[model samples]
Structure formats: C-alpha cells, structure tokens
Target: MKTVAFVPIKLNSQRLPHKNILPFGDKPLCWHVINELINVKQIDEVYVYCSDEKIINYIPKEAKFLKRNPNLDGDLVKGFDIYKSFIDTVGADIYVLAHTTSPFLKSSTISSALLKMIESNYDSAFSAKKVQTFAWFDNKPINYDLNDIPRTQDIEPIYVETSGFFMFKQDVFTKHQRRIGFNPYIQEIDEYEAVDIDTKEDYEFALKLIKTLNENGREQHV
Candidate 1:
C-alpha cells in the first residue's frame, strides 16, 4: 500500500502567531515532523498541506506541498476538515496524520506504530501518554473512585490526549469520515514526546528542552 505522511500546517495560530515557522534548535519546528516522515521507510511520500507561502517555501524538496483549499482554511472550520480534505484529495491507501507542533516525536516510534497497526489489521492508530491517576473535577473523582486518588499506583492506566501522530487506513477513513475508525489502537509514548506547541509558553518550553538535549549531545531522533 502506498503510504503518504500528511502534515497540515496553518500560518495563523490563535495562541502563538506564525507558530509553524518558529525555530526549534537548528531547524523550524515543522521540520521535525517532516524529517521524521522522510526517514520512515513505510511512508512513500510526504505532503505538507498549508496556505502560507512562507511555510510552503520552508518545506524540504522531498516533500510535496498540498496547497490548502480556501474553504477549509477559515478559522471556524475544524482542523479535522483539513485532514479530511487532504485524504480525499490525495486518495492514498494509507495516511499518516501528523502535526508540526510536536517536535519530539521519533521516526522510529512512528514506524513502529505503523507496523503494529498494519500487523494487527487496525483501521487507525493514535499516540498517547499513559496516565495512572484518579483525576478529579469539582472535588469529584472523574476517571476513578474517590478513594482511589490516595492510592494512585492502584488506579487503572488511562491514555491521555497526546495528539502526537496518527496512522490511518484511507479505505476505512472514507467510510468512517474521521481519523479514527471502528478498530483503533493507542500508541503510548512518553509525556515529553506528547508536547504540542500552542502558545508562547509552549514554544519556550520546547525550545528549552531542545537546547538542553543539544547541549548534552544527546542522540536526536525526531
């Protein structure tokens, strides 16, 4: 099956302006996702879907730029629409839905997730961070018994919203009309790997983390 790694980027960010183009370490944040997709052997192609000319120019030569449709570029339309638009337009057998904001994702992680999904015959798979906490809201327990909050280790593990990446079967998506379908699997990742850049604070934190890694000469995977 032909697999295309799709990244939907936008110039206007509500929390942080021009966030997609923001620098992280030696390259822009978006480059992290692009690089990972490029390195993944399963993905035959990489598409950078966006309306911004700056972002378009920033994309590497290996990636194909999918000019965003004007209708789906509005602020009111959800980001899911953009993903759907690309999936419909490209018509690939497999689609890897990725975000430019997540710079810590490793190419190996994405490859492993894709292999796992394919081998298991999963319709779709998304990354998450495992949480083992008795979350509460308004002094009431949300995901666990009220008494379980104190005994945190005993609580059942839950997958938190990581939003790192997704591996989708295009055939199932056209029928389901969403990234996730009837058969969905969760790929658990570390908390740091799930960091998404949404605000100035988020950008700063990511930059600091990247800088620390660079200074330590740690093996960079993303």
Candidate 2:
C-alpha cells in the first residue's frame, strides 16, 4: 500500500566530520540517496530528516524536509530512538529507512525489496550482502573447521545487513520497537552496492569505485 522513504541525516559525524554534506560524485553525498528515494515509483513520498537547516538547499523540491529533535542530536544517541521519533511524528503504513552513507544504492533495489516484502508477507525487509567466505570467532573457525575444509561454493551463504535500506510495516516498529521484526526478509545486494561511508578511507574507496564503474560505462542505477 502506502510507503514512504525517510532519509535521516545529521550534521555531526565522528570519523568523517561534516560527511553528510560532503561533495560526492555530482552533488553533496546525501543528495544521491535523497534523489534516488524520490525517483522510486513504489515510494509515495520521500522525507529528509535532518538537524541542519542548510540541508534544505541540497534536497530536491519533490522531497519533504523534517527537522530532527535536538535532544537526539548527540553522537552517543542511539539510532533506534531517532527512528522512534520519526515513527511517532510522521505516520505511514510502511516506512523505508535509508542511509546517505550508501550513495550507490539503487531505486530499483529499494522497490524490489518493498515488493518482495509485500508479496512474501514479510514483516520487514533490509538490504544485505551474501557472505560465503570463511569466518572465525573467538579464535576458532566458524563456518569451517580445521578438520574439515570444504569448497567455498559448498558453504551456506550468510546474509550481512548492509544498513543501506530497510522496508518495514509500521506494526513492526510498534511491536518490536525496531525496524526489523521476527519475520524479516533479507534482500541480497552486491558488495559495491553495500558500501557504507563511515571513514575517510571508505569515502575515497567509494569515489574510486564510482569512477572506475563510470569509466567502464556502467550506469549507476541510482
């Protein structure tokens, strides 16, 4: 039914200061995600939640802007609380949580995830990357044991939440107080699409990857 995409952004960042407004490929970093969400046909509306008023200049006219709570503006504030605030204010049947860090995320992927959630009767859906490589924990092999080493292809794939985007029914948040519910679906995306800009190194890597992809004539779906 009715779905809305929310892009939560803040002015302060610990690792990469002022990263949300940093210069990305063509425009500011967050603009890429904002524009993508606005273009998605499945989404009825797109909202930009930010504390800074200056961000208004970057967001397109098609999207709406909402001021974030100043109390939740600190770096130590939990993201779950911020999301709860959004839910409490802007009511929607389905909410699509997206991040500016994932600049390469595509509108088609967002639409696909939402469609899958509806068709499959999933309470929630999130973007993830399929991981099949060997993993270790507590100084021991996790997926494979030293005694038995199997081919990588034979190993079962694990899905890692990319935090790129999430689609969930409002009831999911009301019941679990979180974006993900008990019956959640994971939409697998490629590693490149899952890239999250947290640090300077990550930003550089993403820029380089974007440049390389463009050079190869690969059109970025977003």
Candidate 3:
C-alpha cells in the first residue's frame, strides 16, 4: 500500500507564537518531524501541509510542500476537517497524520507502528503513554478501591494519547471520519519520546533536552 506522512502546520500558534519555526537544536521545530518522516522507509512520501508558504524555506528538499486553504487554519477548525482535506488532496492507501510538536518521536517507532498496524487485525494505530499510577476520574478512584488500595505497580494502567502520530488506513477515516477505527492499536513510548511542545514551558524544556542530547552526541532516535 502507498503510505504517506504529513505534518499539518499553522504559522500562528495561540500558546507559543510561530512555534513551528522556533529554533530547536540545529533546525526549526517542525523540521525535526519532517526529517524523521523522510527517513522512515515505510513512508513513501512526506509532506508539510500548511496554509502559509513560508514553511517551504524550513522543510528539507525531500519533503514536499502541500498548500492548504487558510480557512482551515482557524482555531476552532476540527482535526477531522483537516484530515479529510488532506486525504482528498492526496491519494494514498494509508495516511500518517504526524505532529510537528512531537519533535523527539523516532522514525523507527513510526516504521514499527506502520508495519504492526498493517500486519495486525487492528484497523488503526497511534502512540500513547501508559500511566500505571493511581488514577481518578469524575472524583472517583479509577484503578483502586477506597476500601482496598493496591500497590501502584499492581494497579490497572491507563493510556494517555500523545501528539506523536496517528496511522490509519484511508478506508478507516472514510468509514468513520475519525483517526481511530473500531479496534485501534496502541504503541507505548517512553517519557522522552512523549515530549510534546505545546506550551512555552514545554518548548523551553525541549530546547534544553535537545542541547543536552547534542552535548552527549546522542541521535534523535534515542
């Protein structure tokens, strides 16, 4: 199947202005994910979908530029709309919806997710962090009972979806108009890989982490 990856970027960020273009190590923030996608052998092509043409200067030569309607750049615009727009514009059996915010996400994990999703019976797959601590929801304990409390390690784990990537077959989206299908595959990643830069503090931490990695001569895959 023809698999394609795309990172939907908007120049104006509400939390952190022009965050996609901000300096992250040796390259812009968005450049990291684009570069990782390009290196993934499972992905046939990588594209940077943005309303602004300025992104063309930041992306690598291998990554294509996909011009999207500016109207879709609204703060209230749903991700489903953007997914549909991209699917309609580009033809592919499988579509990879990646996020520039997840700069540290590895290409090997992406390739593994794609291969696992295609090989397994699940219809879609995405990355998430497994929280195995005492959890609560609606003011009630989720994995523990008030009368009988279990050890944190023995508690049921809850999965929190991260801004890493969403892999789904074209038909999965066409059928449900959603990124996740009936039965979804969840890939667990470490805290370092789950770092998503959505706020100013996150950006600062990511920048520091990038510098630390460079100082130690560690690759992005780590």
Error of 3 at 182 (Å): 1.2
- Clash pairs, candidate 1, are none
Off by over 4 Å in 1: 137-139, 147-150
Instruction: List RMSD in Å for every model shown.
Output: 1.9, 1.3, 1.5
Tens-digit lDDT track of model 1 for 1-222:
788889888877778988888777777778888988898998899999887667766667788888887677677998777887887688788789999888898888889888877788788889999988766669876677654355667777778757689888886777777787778888888867888888999998888887787789888753
lDDT of 2 by residue, 118-166 (tens): 7887989999999998988799877877798889999766778997998
Best by lDDT: 3
Q: What are the runs in model 2 whose C-alpha is more than 4 Å off?
A: none
Model 2: number of backbone collisions: 0
For model 3, which pairs clash? none
Per-model TM against the reference: 0.91, 0.95, 0.95
The CA lDDT of each predicted structure is 0.81, 0.87, 0.89
Question: For model 3, how many clashes?
Answer: 0
